[model samples]
Target: MNFVHFATDIAHVSGFSALGLFIGLLLVFGIGRYIGVRWLLATESEHTSAGLLDGAIFGLLGLLIAFTFSGAISRFDDRKEMVITEANAIGTAYLRLDLLAVETQPALRALFRQYLDARLEIYQKLPDLKATEVALVRANALQGEIWSAAVKACEVTGSVPTTNLLLTALNEMFDIATQRTVVALEMHPPTIIYVMLFSLALISAGLAGYTTAGIAKHSLTHMVVFAAIIAITVYVILDIEYPRLGLIRVNSVDRVLVELRKSME
Candidate 1:
């Protein structure tokens, strides 16, 4: 995988909070050190304009943080809902299996069990592309099996209420699975947005350090606290954005799917 993909995988596994904090502090401290060195070598000028620019940039950062944070929260909620919806769809389809003829019921139910097992396995292998792919292939094959069985059963018996119901439920089950998969893929914000946010943060920190160079002594406490706040905010944003990989994960909501599987048993 490429760098972006590898980094994303890492973020999903352990999240970016600690890393973000480290980078934030490093930028603040490094920039402060640079400014202190430069201040000693060069004559100082009024920092009024610098202060204005710094404030503007910081304002932009705040706005961007709010925008991304809200988006992350919205997507997180959407994925949670999708999990519940998918579980319901599967449950409905499983129950509809009762509508099938006696001989067809057993085979179809077995396929349903396999399909749910595969679905559960998919979540269990998150951030593992190869394992997820294997699970996806298994799930798709089982879906085909279930679809074929349902169709064959419908063919054996002419148009009837049970046949129609089973086919409809099966289609819904498959449709919701596809929808949920798409939502999962879309949970991330564009990577460029993250890059822009990080760049802005670094620049703002540098400007803050430069503006403080006029002071007799720098306030390490203020700089550290400021950087820590920004880092924590970024961490929270990332946590929400990458729900599967972050501290604030959607894994808890997956209990719906797990319980549905138990009901199958």
Candidate 2:
């Protein structure tokens, strides 16, 4: 398998790994806090050095999260744009079918409808790589059917202009299909990047917790809030990165394709 497909195979694992890492970091930080308190009591070191270390690590974590989040958002927008572009390509191909002979138009239009149905199903089955494979196979078959019919029509009519227009539109539609597939597969950040983020988060959290160790009657609520926020932020980043995997998705953008199909009827 290619790198993209191989990475996709582990998509679910990576997603769940984020959660696991978050929880693991929380536990480590808690334990570190306890140890830190003891160390502080035993040695009575100045808080200034600890506080500086905490701020630096925490700043690094924040910067990493910001970069990851921005990349995810950009990819999300790209997926949305791909949907719109593909929809336009299909709609253009459907309209150009009118240039073909009446006899060929009906069969080609029917193929277009079937192709649309399959394309829509492909998105609906998202995050299910196997189901998507099935849908894509069906869509590719329909595309072949449409192409064959268009070629024969060109041969029969010997009309260069009309044939060129139809073929060009169909070619674009197919190209967009391939582009969409690649974009979907490559949208995620590498697993290693996420692993690094998790590692840094753990270290930063541990230091923060350590800072709290020596203080008497400090609010535990702050730590809880901090951990929860980090967890939720990481979850959102994952959700946006893999739009098909979580509550966040590109399904809403399917409306453009849906409308194109409706107009065809």
Candidate 3:
């Protein structure tokens, strides 16, 4: 899971019963202490070596998280850019359709409107995969209507040039939509990797807490800062990976749909 999904999981964890919280905290401290003790004992370093070892553990955790999260964040930005590109592509195609004969406008616009609605419906169904599949089938069927209508315009007018433009625009629109879907699916966090990261993060957190007790003059602020950073970072990663929810969302294609609606006027 990306940062968003991970945050949801943590948010879910926060709601656990008191007993669960107690056990969780206990495990953190206990497991952490065990690991810290073994690690520190096995070392034959100087007296001030504890802090260094502890810092090393934290540093390693930071590195692992940064690497994974950086990739996720890059993908998140790419998804956003693709959305804008798709909107532009569709808009361009819609405008080009205007150059066709006046007789063709009404049917083409109507088909465009239906296509936009069907497209929006596809995303709205995304919360449920089964529903999304159903929506895609319907959307694809609508696209067929669009295809038939576009083709019929050229055949009726017997203008090869007009047909060529309509076909070009429709083809690009379809390509853009497919690209958007592929990006969304691919950008999601891999479940297996998420599990591994979480397991490691837990161990890292436990070790962090355990080693904390072994040190003196350890600022409460430092601990708070680290925890906050880790939690927030995890949450953001989830957001990027699961763009369907929270602050970063795969927005509905409302803008294009609204524009298409206006053409009816």
User: Evaluated with lDDT, which candidate comes out highest?
Assistant: 2
1 against 2, candidate with superior lDDT:
2
Please, what are the lDDT tens digits per residue for candidate 2 over residues 1-265? 2533554545566557667766776787788789887787443365666667678888889999999999989988998999999999999988887777777778788889999999998878866668777888899899899899889977876799998898999999999898887656665777788888888888877887777777787686887777778877888887787667667878889999999889878
The lDDT per prediction is: 0.75, 0.81, 0.64
RMSD to the native, candidate 3? 5.3
lDDT tens digits by residue: candidate 1, 159-184? 58878798888888998888766546
Kindly report which residue stretches of model 2 are placed more than 4 angstroms away from their true locations once superposed. Answer: 1-11, 41-46, 128-130
- TM-score, structure 3 vs. true: 0.73
Q: Between candidates 1 and 2, name the one with more favorable TM-score.
A: 2
lDDT of 3 by residue, 126-195 (tens): 4555566666677678778878877877787777877788789889888888776654565555667666
What overall lDDT, based on C-alpha atoms, would model 2 receive against the true structure? 0.81
Best by TM-score: 2
Model 3, which residues run further than 4 Å from truth? Answer: 1-26, 34-53, 124-134, 189-192, 215-229, 250-257
Reference-based TM-score of each model: 0.83, 0.90, 0.73
Sorted by lDDT, highest first, which candidate order results? 2, 1, 3
